[model samples]
Target: MELNRFYCGDAIKIMQTFSDNAIHLICADPPYNLGKDYGNTIDRKEWSAYETFTRDWLTQAIRVLRNDGTLYVFMGVRFIARLYAILENDFGLLFNGWITWHYTQGMGRIKGYSPRHEDVLYFTKSKDFTFNLDDIRIPQKYYRERNNMDGANPGDVWQFSHVHYSSKEREEHPTQKPEAVLERMIRASSNPGDIVLDPFVGSGTTCKVARDLGRRWIGIDVNPDYIAMSERRMAQTATLFDSFDPRLKRTPLDLPR
Candidate 1:
């Protein structure tokens, strides 16, 4: 089936139509089971049903991925245990890293130092997968100190924080991830013109970043609002996606202030 640039529909059903080995990467930001209002949040699910849901998507995603393709799933820190069980029991050796995106926010009024980071679970279909570490390195705060080491390869503790509170990228959606974060993943994981799939494309941030970086992207969102927001964001981006370059001056994405 010839999928268009973006689709506004149920992600599971839409994913079923895609061909095997077609997509290079599946970067999913599915519901976190936080029991809150996502654009069109599913009525909260029971534990068994939640596992079933994960299994269903994993089955379909694995089928569509090439041997070299990778699946990167972002979830809350609290979800690690259950999700890890699901990955181990169901997917076996395919599990890769329990990469932590260490951000600098999320502390509540309670006891501990707040929960700011997230888990970006990496699962490759096979041993041979695309992972170019050199391309995604953040500039060393102390470039002079590190003489030979290839920039600060922070390994999973991604030190970059979420978009700042005064950041312009903040959207109405509570769960919107920053574009800088997506930029790192898209760059380090896939090459230019690679097929990047974002199944839960809230506010189309992933698609926008993909487009701005010259990747061929397919974004599916359950909400029309998100789809519209993504399209507007694309239009806001001046260059045609085909001509985009990573070296272009990063136009700070506008957001609610």
Candidate 2:
């Protein structure tokens, strides 16, 4: 219920206390049901039980979201389609984009190809939503005379490196997201001083990025360790925030005209 702070509790229960249409943006990265250890909480759930959990939390998220608010949910391949159905068919939120987060390295497989991507479903509560395309634009591949000259629209498929265990930005959480990924979402969807909510704030990437960008944030996680982890990470980041998209280094090819 508090803004710009991390609350340790059940996401659904905590979210219920929020007033209606109070959130400008919601970035939810719930359990993928992969049986990963999350400290005091089990990631594994029965198929029906998982569906119920997903539906309930999503309902709360949608309730708190403003009419023009945007919601971006990170999901695994196992339940991506079902989640999409719940958002579009059941809830009727307008489908905005299906973003693919492509990483270079991941678990390799002998029987099949190694998985290198995760999907994020972007939806909006209504037709008109806040999307500052210029705010999120990445450097263009090549500069042209007729081009806007600002930057190019970062397409649906995004390339950001994983916060590797060796990296300093890596947190204790198993499925911690890259900070650059959340930064793009927050910058594009919400304005400065707007309230951004992360219901399942694992590792608190969303909240940290929101705060660094001058937006109000609320992050709730069931695990106390994660809350502490996020707090330490935020405290350490005063001037410079964590890592960024690797592609940001690419300078647009200059053309003589």
Off by over 4 Å in 2: 239-241, 254-257
RMSD of each: 7.4, 1.5
- Score residue 104 of candidate 1 by CA lDDT: 65
Cα lDDT of model 1 by residue, 1-257, tens digit: 44337788878888899998888888888887768587576736886786687778777777777778888888876566787777667776388788787766665867766776788888887888888788765434343533423544446666555655565656667677777667777887788888889888987778888878878889988888888877777777443222122223233333444
Cα-based lDDT for every prediction: 0.73, 0.91
Off by over 4 Å in 1: 1-4, 111-113, 139-150, 164-166, 238-257
For candidate 1, give the lDDT: 0.73
lDDT by residue for model 2 (1-257), tens:
67889999999999999999999999999999989899898889997899999999998999999999999999999999999999999999999999999998899999998999999999999988999999988778788877776878888999888989998778888999988899999999999999999999989899889999999999999989899998887796544545666667789888776
Question: What is residue 146's positional error in candidate 2, in angstroms?
Answer: 3.1
